[model samples]
Target: MDVVAFKQFINDQIQLFAEKLGDAKHSSNDGVSLGKLTFYLAVRQSIDKKASEQDMGLVGAFNDTLQALGMVEPGKTFMSKLDT
Candidate 1:
């Protein structure tokens, strides 16, 4: 499939899976959606994997620092200057 088709397919699958999970299983009671949590976890896992492969702790540390500073939030890819 083309890149666009593949992306759409992935989106459709995630939507279907989310719908199957519904509100109860799809999200925690903290109001964070499962999609957001999943995205954050995926990013963390990728960072960890890269660090492990490269034998560098700085990558993970950088991720942690970003999280601690609230520069990276679940499901948020960019911090808009206009938001504040």
Candidate 2:
């Protein structure tokens, strides 16, 4: 995909991450834990969504963002996947 589309995807996923995080941020119940889990899963899903595509470069980028956000370790991801 073009840079614009790739950027849009990243932005959309970031928005989703923020929303999920908000659920935890605003909740006072045990659901806050669930929301945190949701945030992690959502972040992983976002990276996986881009990883399972034609953009190897984008997958690297998504993974970088994950690491930058402290959501995942860099080497922990994209290690076992087949090379394109």
Candidate 3:
């Protein structure tokens, strides 16, 4: 787990997102609603795709720690076991 590399990756993502944000068309405050939603989804999808390709070892380690502490159960999705 190279901390420097991880930081660089996140910084790169932030810069890219910021550039997209600046380029987003906002002719008027009322006209930006759809554009904002589209940009938000694009950023979210981009981050998810990039993250899936990276080997961030800490993410696995953190999940394992949570499982060991019984904070997370195996083979169960959070959405499937709602408190309500």
Candidate 4:
């Protein structure tokens, strides 16, 4: 999908999750944790040598959403490698 479509899909997914989790702050904590887990899994999948382009796309999409939401700094994502 194109960038716009991908972004829209991500936004929709986020909203859906939020709605399903309800407005209760305490209940939403689990949703946040689930999101983090999903992100880490995507990151790990992206780094796998056997990963397909689709896997990397998912990682990129997740990173894009994070950056868009200001949850991450520009050009810095879980996929970024630290300088040794």
Q: Positional deviation of 71 in candidate 4, in angstroms?
A: 0.8
Per-candidate TM vs. native? 0.30, 0.31, 0.31, 0.40
Clashes of 2: 0
Which pairs of residues collide in model 3? none
Model 3 is weakest, by summed lDDT over 10 consecutive residues, at: 75-84
How good is model 3 by TM-score? 0.31
Runs with alpha carbons beyond 4 Å of true place in candidate 1:
23-84
Give the winner by TM-score: 4
Name the runs in model 4 displaced over 4 angstroms. Answer: 1-41, 79-84
Across 1-84, the per-residue lDDT of candidate 4 in tens digits comes to: 544454455566655665656656647377675675455455444544455676677787878898999888998874453332
* TM-score result, candidate 1: 0.30
| Candidate 1 local lDDT, 15-71, one digit each (tens) | 665565576654454244454445544434443354243223443454557777898
Per-model CA lDDT versus the true structure: 0.47, 0.54, 0.46, 0.61
> Which residue pairs come into collision in candidate 2?
none
Between candidates 2 and 4, the lDDT winner: 4
Clashing pairs in 1: none
Q: How far out, in Å, is residue 24 in model 1?
A: 7.8
